[model samples]
Target: MDKRKKTSQMQERAMKTMPLGVNSNGRYWGKKVTPYFQRGKGAYVWDVDGNQYIDYRLAFGPVILGYAYDEVDEKVISAIRDGVTPGITSQLELEAAEKIVELCPATEKVRLVNGGSDATQHALRVARAYTGKEKIIKFEGGYHGSYDYVLFSTYAPPSTYGNSRSPITVPASSGIPSALGDLIITLPFNNLEILEATLKRCGNEVAAIITEPMLGNFGCADPLPGFMDGVRRLCDEYGIVWILDEVKTGFRIAKGGAQEKYGYQPDITTYAKALGNGYPVAAYGGKAKIMDIVGQGVTQGGTYAGNAVAAAAAKATLEIMSTQNVHGYIDAMGSRLQNGLRAIFKKAGIPCLLSSMPAIFSVSFGIESNLDAREWAKADASIYKKIAARAFEKGILIDEDPREPFCMSYSHTEKDIDDTLEIFDEIVRTL
Candidate 1:
């Protein structure tokens, strides 16, 4: 293993100035700090200490096309040379929005935003304004963003929450106002009976039901069959708006995201992460009837929203994906990795379940029974974390915490998958 002297020095300096020595909480691995990345290209990243690794984290699921892709970088450079941000909207903004409208089925009208958190917060405001209701329903183990409204019940301990049929709303972070918990109703994911029962009692007071089409917070779990259909049906029955939070699943799962993959249309949809590849760009839009109220009664504006550089990057990224069929390449690489890992686990006689789609995957150790987030808590996650640390020492990078998934981009090649699988085999044998 390469010594991380330089990385440790940087962390020591940063800890004196920055809170937790990182900008985002996810960057920390318990008491241990993650390595600082100096540069990235294709499917590889180099640390400040000059150690190279085959990356599967993919910048927390944003580098869909890969790191520093030439085509997108060229477009962004040209846009930056002309101007980064103008007092008024540029032509690039219109072009980027048009691309999103064409690809995503639910977005009849779209508004550019700064990040995933910005899109989710605005979507909730629009929903509340449209239906004139005060409360919202969110599922347990689903992460929309860092905002206070949706932070309830994400990554919470099983003891803090209620039973499987019913769930109690618990704050995921500190310093959030306690009263905000009263406005949110948390329910178990993939359970339609509990959702229907709760909605029947509080349907009139609920403004909307916001959910990630897939549970990205807890290891890339797919939705149970008919769960999404039930959500759509119940929202229509009541007057509650349906907000599909596609922050993690958008643009990576399919051309139109989870909505296209599952054949369910939402009243409001939030887009981010893979939308701009690695750039800072996000959007929230849906049926024209709902978004029309954005400027009229609800306000969603940001200075960095629709900046020239990000707009050009997003436009180029979407065009390349459309013409080149990037999803096809991603699927091939993902399949190779998944199949190879499964074979390794079986040969080593380890109890493992690989939960994922073609773009994202996660490894669960010693889980035999089908489980929701509650039952999953009984499993020893430290086992997976130990394996992840061992893999990192062997020139491979996956999230130490198993909750975050391993994301494959179009840029990942067959060679990278082969090398990763070889390392994975060696690592699992040690366990």
Candidate 2:
């Protein structure tokens, strides 16, 4: 096993000042994974103890091109040296917004923000302002962000999530006002009937229906055929705003994202994660008429919203994505990894289901149909967690939480896939 002694020491020291010894709850995820990363490049990360890992976590799906990618980093550095977060907006902000609008068909106008959570919050606020409504509908296990309004039913325990047709609006975090839960409605994902029924009954009260085009936080669950179309139809019929929270799927899935892949257009789209290739940047925008309210009637402001450095990084990342066939490489590599893992599991006589898009995927052990979040919750997660632990021991890195998908980047190669499969083969044989 790789020695994490130095990492452990740092963790001890960090916990004195920082909660859970990490800056973000995601790093620890209420569980312990000992090695701390010092640096990363291409498809690999080196821990503080100098052990290398083939990174499948990819900083929880943000490092699109790679960690510390030269072009993006150079642009960010240049912008910083020139002066970051200037008192006024810079050309970089417009350049970044233009690039995003050019690529994402759903975004006619765009406004920058600091992170995914903020982007989603802004999108919902705009929706409410536009529709003059108070309630919003979110799918169970579809995590938009940590904000109180969208935090309900995300990561809910099965006991709390009452039933499929009408799920209880269970709070994922405490200190969120109990009254906010009443404003938010929770529904089962991938079910058109319940969604249609809910809209028919409470469509007048709902300001928006926000969803991850493909379920990202629970499993990489794709929308069933016509599911997205149905959503669009219902939104149009009810004058309800549709908000696609593409924080995990944007740029990484395709140049145009899930709206392009699934053939449905949302009124508002929230983007982050892959946009700046690990830099903290986000945006929320949609129809020009709706986005007009952002500055005029509704307020959306942040001290670091359109900082030059992040805008430069996003512009550079988008430029690279526009010119190159990044998705082709990601798709090929992800397919290889998925197919290889399937073969390994088959050879080991273990029943498993693999769900994937080109860029993100998940495996549910002992379950052949991982159709929805509830289905994902029913899988033998302990087995995947064990495999993840074994893979970590063998220098392969994936998050132990099975809910997190394996995020493939443009940096991953055939060799990385092969090496990962070899590790999986070894791990499965022992099981």
Candidate 3:
């Protein structure tokens, strides 16, 4: 358990080269842990000090096939040998795009990017151009990514969020200009009344309304019956573009993403995280009319966009996941964990809610097994944190941040879930 050497080396070397010792907050992974990932395979990873742990973070909703998947590694390495950035064109990019469009009907036209924030930012720009409007509408508990526009109202605790009907546009972090709030209007999620009223008030000024179709931010809130239909109808009525931000829910939920799972289509959709099987790549696309703005003058290009490595990785990732049985296998694995955890807590007399889709699952304390956003707002973070800490010490790693949901990946076997549940049961019994 002595992480001194690894943590020290990271502090001395890694921090000097990178800001805050990492590129993303997910890497920080929260709470007294200095992440110096040395290696990962299947469902396990080892820190620099050789401390091994089962990885439930799964790179924050990516790594669907687990870390360093054999097929993905071979594909990416093979592509590198062909040439890192052949620049002009590669069959890999075309293959990835075509597969994405075929899989997710909501994404009629796709454009590659290097990260989620960039994909989201450019999607907004395209929406703005196509609609000739100014404002963007986002939900209270949705997390799109780290862009000025999408940063507002992502898990801004109930204190600052105000009444759910008239939520405040609180930025996720400092350094964001206050003016960004003016461009974003925050709305309560899982409630159609407020969304309808808000759209009626300023639907004219709003160019696009973006949402996490499955609500990945606050432990996954299912859209109530007709909520999605109402939003889609209103968007059509007012000509407001509806965007489903699937950066987290993309490949995790189902093959066709949330749009398919929920039986609705968005004007625009953005994807990242699992798309490249842990490699850094993302994309945004939708109706051809809206995407056309990207080419005209909206400036949606990245030097690393569709680079050889990411493109090849994505192509291979999609092919593997797109298999007829892969989704079924993933759903089975996730369901096993979800049900096992629920049963474990139930038997332990611990009231807990299990929220999950096909490939992802989360646990919250002090909430019923049937979870909702409002109930999730009342969860005991300290309990989950204590549980996560205990699990980590037992070599089962979960997200240390109180805000993050416990995400399950496709690579985790039923045995992993059984062991996780055993440790969890022991931890909760002590609580």
Candidate 4:
């Protein structure tokens, strides 16, 4: 009778030890609806109560191939058999780095890290070190990592965003020192004019202009035409290190990530997520001239940086991506799902805008365009929340927050797309 009975019990028990009964803040979807997953395989996951659902969250976009992919897992298992972390480098690390250099266009060299946050934090530091500057520029709603330097204007209330010309740098967290905000500048996404003006004013003091190719965190709001190229030109003109934070887009958008897809080269690029197909591996590197500063008095190292397990996972994942049609399959499936959803919304007479690529996109209701986080905040997400919650009840799983995009993987099938559409249609009609 009570499907979530076990889950509720687990939450109550977990809260005694862990804050909010979850390790990550995003995982706490309130005690009532938070799910405790048991295992995942392919495009589906089973909860502790043994309820099955077609998973679209994809562990926040890291499970690119699929959950428990045999090819990746087998490699990781074999590597673990040998050892995990020996606190030193191995041949596997070299192979993984080589594969990255071969595939990603912007990367001439790379330094492995533990996660997206590590990659981004180090990338910023490297930019500052290389340029001999103190200040950095980031776009509003562009989430780089959990570090203090980047924890501004992300998830902050739109009312606090101030004017578009001179936006307030609202800190995302409280513990961040107010003095840090002075060194950082936050601007709206998709607006190159503001970026150019800001850079012209303080370009010499700015070390890097770090941005996601698209707003990955706030409903995948895409760059306007020539936006990426404009950023490159301005960065070159101002002598600013362009750090493309592609933790979400890398290995998922294309074989060469955003650099290949958009044809705009960045001075430095940070990658995670699909790089290891859900394993804890990430990297930051770019032009040899910029990245070579890492060892020569510019410190960048980690205890588990090049662990064998993560390296093997990255090597296997990239090798499979190179040999197989991973992106092709994911694109096809994603397009099918996107088309089906568009048709459903059209038939329902509801205003909706889908932003970004087929593989990673967002469905925003009652919003014509999403150029930046401020515009995206105007979307009537309550309808989306209702649809997502009801769909979850009917064996579909998606993030309730509309800002988070729906991620597709190679494992999602045509049948899965059709089934999802059917369920969405049913729910939309009721709404």
lDDT agreement with native, every candidate? 0.87, 0.88, 0.80, 0.93
Segments in model 2 whose C-alpha atoms lie over 4 Å from true places: 29-32
Taking the tens digit of each residue's C-alpha lDDT, what string does model 3 give over 45-162? Answer: 9977788888888878788888888899999998889887765767888899999999897778999899988888888888888889989988777888777777876756756787
Which pairs of residues clash in candidate 1, taking residues 3 or more apart in a chain or in different chains?
none
In model 2, what is the error at residue 224, expressed in angstroms?
A: 0.6
Q: Relative to the unseen true structure, what is the C-alpha lDDT of residue 420 in candidate 3, on a scale of 0 to 100?
A: 78
TM-score computed on alpha carbons, candidate 3: 0.94
Off by over 4 Å in 4: none
Expressed as tens digits, the lDDT of each residue in 1-431 for candidate 2 is: 63877887888888889999888787873333666889999999999989899998998898999988998999999999989888688899999999999999878999999999999999999999999998999888899998888888887775678878777889988789999888999998889899988888889999999989877988777788888888899999999999999999999889888877666689999999999999999998899999998877798999999898789989999999999999888999999998898899988888888886858988888777766778778788889888988899898989878888999989988988888888889889998
Q: Which candidate has the top score in TM-score?
A: 4
lDDT of 1 by residue, 206-275 (tens): 9999988767878666678898889999999999899999988899989888888778799999999899
Supply the TM-score for candidate 1: 0.98
Ten-residue region with minimum lDDT total, candidate 3? 367-376
lDDT of 4 by residue, 151-189 (tens): 999989777989999999999997999999999999999
Output the better candidate (1/2) by lDDT: 2
Superposed on all Cα atoms, model 1 deviates from the true structure by an RMSD in Å of 1.3
Q: Which pairs of residues collide in model 3?
A: 353-369
TM-score of every candidate: 0.98, 0.98, 0.94, 0.99
